[model samples]
Target: MSAPVVSVDATPVRAIALILIGMACISVNDMLIKLLSGGYPLHQMVFIRSVIGIMAASVFVWLEGGWRILKTERPGLHLIRALLIVSANMIYFAGLSVLPLGLATALFFVAPLFITLLAIPVLGEAVGRHRITALFIGFTGVAVMMLPATDWSDIPRAALLLPVIAAACYAGMQVMTRKLGAKSAASAMAIYIQLAFIVVSCVSYFAVGHGRYAEGLDSESLIFLLRAWVWPAPEDIWKFAVLGAMSAIIGYCLSAAYRLGNAATVASYEYAALPMAIMLGWIVFAERPGWIMLLGTALIAGAGLYVFARERHRAAPGEVPGPAAERPLRRG
Candidate 1:
């Protein structure tokens, strides 16, 4: 379904519901990638998902207007935006292939901190003392979450960077999205993103999908990157379809949520993904964070919410809302 365009009469409750559903889809997508990461090349999985995602995005385009909405004035900017998001997905999937779900999810929460910081230079947005403090607390939470992990040394230090770097790319995409304004239909944006995935994955497949470079790789992430493309096992085929479908669902719902709901309120609700991710990690993978890590996760969420609140407060009566973490963080 098409997301409602932003209107004066907002339906905050329905927007809240949409955000919950979107986050759930994201959590499922993450789990699927992690599961698939062990067996198939990342490009192979991404190419399949992108192919399916293009079809689903077509439906959204149809629902929004028609194929005509795909037209854009700034093709280069869109390509750059698509590249940023795809980079985020690849890096995150690499990390998720090795890290526990809960820790990875918590690390990704640093996106808000990145957004707030990046906004200043990239968007020329003003930041006050309070929001700055929130950024510090959120990053401190990242350190706190990792500090107590007895097994942290076992993980390749580089593997731990997957979520944070991915988050930075995601935030960069959002900044570009903001600069692009609300001119294009969200579905159109999604289509190009899928296209970028298809092109990039195809290139990767041709370059190294023969497993030539995968021979001596010890890093799970690197092996995942260069491994030969395999025909997915029969049972895993449907899971790939689910990943594509989930991507379309996420694009539509998050777009609709931000448009239809109060930005600050709806953005705060997006934090629900943290708990959802953790719970799914526990149930599906039998992984759970310790109390200390949970506390750190809470701190990260609190800081993000605090930033949202500050954005709301800074938006004087009838003035345009400042940027918060309206991240279209489609999971890897």
Candidate 2:
């Protein structure tokens, strides 16, 4: 059977709002993650966040009519997608544990580049010479951005691999989304992924022992890590609730955005998250990204924008088309 197609039209104001809200929620999620990295084990953080996500999703499923909302014709694909997402989260969090928030996030943006390459095989879409050339330029930019630190010998090389691997897994997850298409509910897919995360986190936590929990940091750092496990304070409960609500809202908005515009267009705009994160880091944490990092961000953003523009031009009517077609793949 042919894959399901979502309609793409002029962007809506509400869609823009949804995208912004989604970006903010995701940014906040990352900040919380950064906060928790020092004390709580990454596995524990994954487990807690997944549990919160599942619980929140479960409520929606129940309110939407119980088991039916969880139904899917593609269980195996769901499993694959979940595995990809879980892996991506683990790798991403691991990278976050060591890397600066903005830097790690910048590297993660490479996932779209990977997704473009994967589409050729996974989606059977042809990528033409020009798009391929653009893709190469993009990767070159990514490589430049990924240049080793001046004190590279001081840092463990292994640490650098984590974000790269995470980006690949995330890209795989996005490609699978297109493959799964409308055959599955986005909420169900998200639910199962969280379930997978819970399972993995439980396994890792038991294997590693809770005693290794970040114990030696100063009080301030200790509080940050503990933030992941601690129940929301009276004042903070509303914040967590807002986070969950925002998650659902963003989920719907992304779904709607995909329906209204090509994935390339939507994905291009996603880079907006980077600037937002950078600003958040500055305003909230008094952190500023370095010039090299900014240059790297520019390269990556430029590459993505180049690909996005090319895809849009090709998709436009009466244009001399390239072999690479912009297909809207389901990406969570």
Candidate 3:
């Protein structure tokens, strides 16, 4: 039998759908990471997922013309991007293990603002009054979300910092990505990230996960970090593999969405992940965000939209959007 031909029209509707699907996949990936974190060392799951991620990335690289096409003159920059990814994922994953998914994701959404701030120092990008105001409003939202009604002693205050720190690291990575711009291919960069994740995961497993124990730590985040290595259940092995596939799927969908549609429009659709995370958290974990947290999320999202709108308005006709304007929220 002959194969059938299939054509995909990259319309606005299709792009939006792709972005939403990518966000949904990312949310599912986060949920799986949270579920696995309870029993396995975070690095172990990351290591396994990276292994699969590398394979998936490899397939894409091959389709794009093999290893030679993945060449980059800027190896050092790639390593830095990888390190940032490792750090951001570690912090965000730790937060996910302990914090409510909605809250953690809401906090992480502040990365766009962080990117605006970092660009001034890292990319030498000019930041005007509007961007500065957005940054201020975004950080205010962070403060609002971080302050619990009862007390800091009631929850692990340190754990709360994880997502904030993750936002910083994630923003740094995005800035680096923007710096590299057309110098590197996105698929090749992704492969490097997966490779870096594997290296870091192995080092972490050997250094801290091999014979470690939580000891007397009562914090969920601490326990998740210091937990010793163990053989994953067979079912979990499958889950991790699925997560690996989802990682690649997310990369492709996000890339396609941005390539097909307006970057600002696609970026807005990325917020779809927040609601998806909230719904998953509620249905799977029976968790709900407080009104304060919800309000904070609104503030953060609004600030992000302001920044996005400003970027779109500033771009000259036919000019490609800057990374800050086009980059979607980093999925943890």
Candidate 4:
């Protein structure tokens, strides 16, 4: 029997649902990184994860018809994207090593705002008064979240800087992804990113010395690594496997969403990951953001949602839109 035909146009509710699932997958990926960090060097963990991802992507390509899908007209753009993504991952993992999950995730929220600013230069997407106001509010939220008025005299300033740098690199990656979208398949982009990460991780790992990897693995760390590697005594192997599967699914959905909608719109929904991450952290790790952090998160989420809603309204027929209409706003 022939496969059933799926609708090309997903309802807004369906798109929102897929997005939420994608966000959950992303949050769980972060949780896994945190778990593995305890037992392995961040570089090694990134390398291993990238290797797994590369293998998974390879299979996907083969089933989809080999090197044809991997072929890209924009190899240079792909390389640039790889570099940005690798750098962003390194910085983000470094930040995660020190900063709490919620805080680190909060800092990473700046990527969307950065993307909004970048759209003008890279994608030539025009920004309007409403988006400008939203951007200001969003940045204010970031400032409040990152530089809160608290006793931070002893904290390493690097903690704050790392995520900011990561966010900037991530924004660049998003812009590049938008540029490449016209010429490449989503699977191709995913393959390039995974391969780039694998190469980067391998280089970083060997340069750092393998002994450091062994040294980093204490009993607790060993247990975490072993669980990840072997799935030993894992009560949640199925859960982790599902998480991995969801990662691939989310990648596809996000690509589709961006293809169908604007990046700024999709990016606005990206902040949805924050509240989910915060709640997960609170429940799983007993972590909680302070009142100020909560307020900042609210601002960020609201601003992003505003952007998303405006984009959606503009995309809908008969809605009076502004500058955003003249240019194509692509996404990662």
Best by TM-score: 1
| Cα deviation of 53, candidate 1, in Å | 1.4
Tens-place lDDT digits, model 1, residues 7-111: 634577788898899888888888898889989999998999889888998998898889887888888887888888899989988899988887888889788
Identify the runs in model 3 with alpha carbons over 4 angstroms from their true place. Answer: 1-14, 150-153, 180-182
TM-score of 4: 0.76
Alpha-carbon lDDT of model 3: 0.79
Query: Per-residue lDDT for 1-332 in model 2, tens only?
Result: 11234445455555456556667667777777666565555666666666677777776557545667676777777788778777776677676666666767777777767877888888787877866776777667667656775523344556666777888887777777666653444455456766887898788766654544445644333333333344444655554555445445545446555555555556566777788878877776666777767877787667767777877776665342222223222223
Better of 1 and 3 by TM-score: 1
Candidate numbers sorted by lDDT from highest down? 1, 3, 2, 4
Extract clashing residue pairs from model 3. none
User: How high is the CA lDDT of each candidate model?
Assistant: 0.81, 0.62, 0.79, 0.61
Q: Please give the range of 10 consecutive residues that has the lowest summed lDDT in model 4.
A: 323-332
Which residue pairs in model 2 clash with each other? Answer: none
Candidate 2 local Cα displacement, residue 252, angstroms:
4.5
Pairwise TM-score winner, candidates 1 and 2: 1
TM-score of 3: 0.89
Candidates ranked, most accurate by TM-score first: 1, 3, 2, 4
Best by lDDT: 1
For model 2, state the Cα shift of residue 272 in Å: 1.0
Q: Going through the candidates in order, what is the number of backbone clashes in each? A: 0, 0, 0, 1
| Candidate 4 per-residue C-alpha lDDT over 30-58 given as tens digits, one digit per residue, 9 for 90 to 100 | 77666556545655565656555666666
Residue clash pairs of candidate 1: none
